[model samples]
Target: MQPVQAPVLGPQVDYRSLVVVLLSPLAFALVFASWTIFAVLGVELKRVLLFGEVQFAVLLAMPMLTGALAALPMALLARRVGGRRVMIGSLLLICPLLWAIAYSDVYLEFLLAGAGLGLGAGSLAAGLVYVASLCPRRHAGLALGLYGAGMLGAGLTYFLLPLVSQAYGWPMAPKLFLLPVLLVALLLWIFAEDAPRMPHAPLDSLAEPDGARSESPSWYWLPPPAVCRLALYYSFFYGAFVALALWLPGYLAAQYALPLKQAALWALAFTLPVGIGQIVGGALADRRDFRDLRWWVSACVMVCLFLLSYPDFTMQIHGVHGDIALRFSMPLGGFTALLAVMGMAMGIGKGSLMCLLYRDHGDDMARSGGLALALGGLFAAVLPLMFVLGNEWIGIRTAGFMFLYAALAVCMLLMLWDGARTRSSPLTRHSSQPPSQAD
Candidate 1:
């Protein structure tokens, strides 16, 4: 028999060699901002269109829901048409959708426009795949971090869009926004290079069976166990993070009775910590193993759960009907510390998860990334419904939800530890070694 050989890794890529890497990040940034347009614009849209809270929330979440479902399909589309073509098509599609949203006079029209929002955000799955394919294995972590910076683009919409809305009004905001997205797409067309496809396990070929194929019968295209682990982790990570992003503003306003402006400021504080954490987390993941990461993330979740459970102790923002006698002396400091911890954990966990997937999946990053994203989005849908139902039926609040979810996280972590241990055991035979061939 011919000797088995490891597939060759892509050549080491310099910063200059990977221009499309920048496009993925840029694409992600735009999608992040667009995905959040509802949160920023929902109130205005409600007033302009005379819609209810339920209606508004649906509109706000429709893009996210659709984007979640669209990721796999988008990945498939990218495979069929090419990432560059799909990305540009998605971006151009968004311009008309923005105009439709801007000019929409009815709820149905706005909802239709919301579908367009999903289309734009769906591009992220494809972009993640594209960027991962371009980077050398060693640099995937850094590339994910840079791609994560696109998440900060939401902050831009929150801060700048409001200012722009004040000056130009709500309808005009989307119209003006189109110019920048179009410009970025134009830049990407000129500067972004195509990703180089690498040889994969023949089992991994997404293409339908043609008459002939690669000759390597020994090769397999299965996703690495590490990638599956990352996907599982992301279901909890993004679910919790994005749920908080969607839920916190409402929680602050209703539970704490803060003025809208103050609540918005508080929400900003909450989000800012996550972005900071992302940077710190990405750096740590580059160095730390998943074993250490488990402890760190668990600890962060526990602390945040504690803080969230005790609003009176943590913030005292809620009005106390019975007694003003109770006080947590260092409430603000303690709350800030916990939030920072949670943010750092999320940041690190998010980047590490992507990095691990890339290490395992390598050139098949799109399929793996799409799976990760879809699972996370799936959790995002389920978790919120559970939260709402728990609130309605059992009178559980956000803190209660946090405590419950955090417990689930602990259990999942244990499961992962056990799984990892089993996978690392010597009992599993290597491809080259027979069961009776142990040395």
Candidate 2:
């Protein structure tokens, strides 16, 4: 049996929803940029505060910590009252935090402000649910891809903040976001549409793909907790992409001896590709099931990580002529290429996985998207600290990549086992096949 498609909607609805989807990324991008504020701004702050690597990691991750904590509740709230209200309120909520960060000098003050950036995460949760609710199935991947591309806004600070900080000063940088955030919030308040909430129902993965016009069901309707499975898989791609996006400028500068702005620019090789790949992933996902696609995405990411994890090495050998020394390291170009490819793979995986989530849980995106983002946020929060710890314990600058490699390998293995077990189950076969074919 084929998957069910979304019911056809009138052209007016189609046009309105498309408009909402097109503009939705602005809101998502604003929240995402806010969520990742520390990535670039912290470079200057780190210099002023004279914090240790560990403390810097903490500062870098604090927003993610709070964001993860906030995602689910915001999602639940959106479910009851509708995503539009939650999203609008969430967008407006970050204004004070930005103002506070601009004025504060203390690390605690900054951290407290950073914690409020969790509202940015909640906004993302609301925004994702909103888009999922309105987007039709035929273009589901593209819709999610556009929403995911809001991560590109993280690059806005990466590219522009340093310039803003250089001229007006670091304090002035956060203020730049104030206008755009307000504008997006206002637009969403006026124009966004959310799927009407239905009576609470059990998890149903077999729900129709067209989310907005469908008889949308309640949260996590899939049996055996498919939402959790989707969340877990997406967490790796999203978590790693976000962690690296936040951590890479620092790593590039430290490892390559580049200036801060220069390093941030180079890190865009990673982030820009990740953003664009979301579109690619979404487009591809529209054509087929993404379970198989994710295997390729995961495998590509692993291969890239395997290469990236190897540190620069110097080798010596005694020869008849004389002692010979050979030095090997990833050149800037090679490293950037690999990073871009890895980012692409991660982006594609994220886009496809989100689409998969919608295919299974589109009717329940408020809960599903919230849980997924929450897990990704928590996972992202842990990665930088792990990178710091891995370096201290292992004494390799590339230790972060190594840790990611190992983590991915473990997940792949576990998923492989799970897939094998599921395939072997008679009940799984019976449930998967249509009634006409089950016999």
Candidate 3:
């Protein structure tokens, strides 16, 4: 008698899952919108708390360090407890913390609130892993890109939060923010599904039925090298962005000798473009038409460096502050152009690496995403320290330290080039495909 063939359950190919996948990032993004509140709020808090410069920087950076350390564990927890559970729980947990920050009287109490927010923000890593596991093989890039827009939520907050805080007061500003969080949390709690289990069937028969585990899937996890490079790249990429996010206003204030509000408004021009660039880069990644991401990313980096190198660019305007006349000159155009290019590079590079990693190592996304957060967090944590050290040693009169940041980006590109050359094997190539209808 001829041997019978086993049946395949086939892949769960659908676009509707994309919407579900996106919610995690969207929720996480909103949480991260509050992540930098400590940094933003610290400006006012420090005045009341009377912290030293180093202490202020510490408060600004510790949340990132805490969040980074928390990511891997959160990923593992999500897998065990269910992604929807952890995600919804995180949103709920953040509500009290945001409200607490508004009312805290003591500095230590406020810092503790910031730390609590960091713990809540760990949802981002879990969300990334959750989204990665949701989509079928083919649309992973586009799916991840849409989800990744959560990172841009910070830019939105930076531009808008101050205005809100000014109008409603800091205490009430977060209350308004929490409204959206509550709404998103409710939706995710009700709608998000747990990861589906592979159906089981009898194993004794030679001819296995459909949905049986007669054969193992061919998917592999992210490799050690790719993980290392990704960490390195994200470390620099996120570090640069974080450093800018924290210090740009201060830099502009000193450079132009502008008042606090004017400096912040000018910095908004620099940071807001980041969101636009990220969206544009995501659109590019979704198409997958841009094969050599390195070339485009490198070009953007070079343009950014060139624009940032020009020290004489001016952005001066007159403003009245309570009947006192003021004149300020900001490097608005130069800084904005540089930030936009960096944002574009970060978006393109991050999405490309994620697409490539998932394509090659779908099974390893949990680990890869964890590692990305770890290193990225470490970089973000250390960046404030770098700014302090750079200013202390060399002064902000030059771009020397900024070049160190640029060099790190260049090194990441080199590593990617090396990986492309050495690791592009036949099996890897074959497996690194988007899902097919037949998969």
TM-score of each: 0.80, 0.90, 0.77
Cα deviation at 286, candidate 1, in Å, is 3.4
Best by TM-score: 2
- Model 1 quality (TM-score): 0.80
- Name the runs in model 1 displaced over 4 angstroms: 1-8, 15-18, 46-53, 79-81, 201-226, 259-262, 311-337, 383-417, 420-439
Q: Which ranges in model 2 have alpha carbons more than 4 Å from their true place?
A: 1-13, 199-224, 319-322, 431-439
Model 3, C-alpha of 290: deviation from truth (Å): 6.1
Tens digit of lDDT per residue, candidate 3, span 279-380? 555456545644467566756766666556454444545556534444433356756656665766766666665665565445656667777777777777
Sort all candidates by TM-score, best to worst.
Answer: 2, 1, 3
Per-residue C-alpha lDDT of model 1 across residues 1-439, encoded as one tens digit per residue: 3344332255577663477767677777777677667666765666677876557656766776777888766865565456776777778778888888788788998888876788775567777766666666556677776776567666666666666677888887677668878987897778775555444432345453565554442333234576666676766776666656655555555566664344445666656766666655655555654545755675667667766665444333445674344564334446446655676677667777666666556556656787787777666655545555545555655544564456556756765786678668765435336633321
Worst 10 residues of 3 by lDDT: 1-10
**Model 3 score (lDDT):** 0.64
**Steric overlap count per candidate:** 2, 5, 3
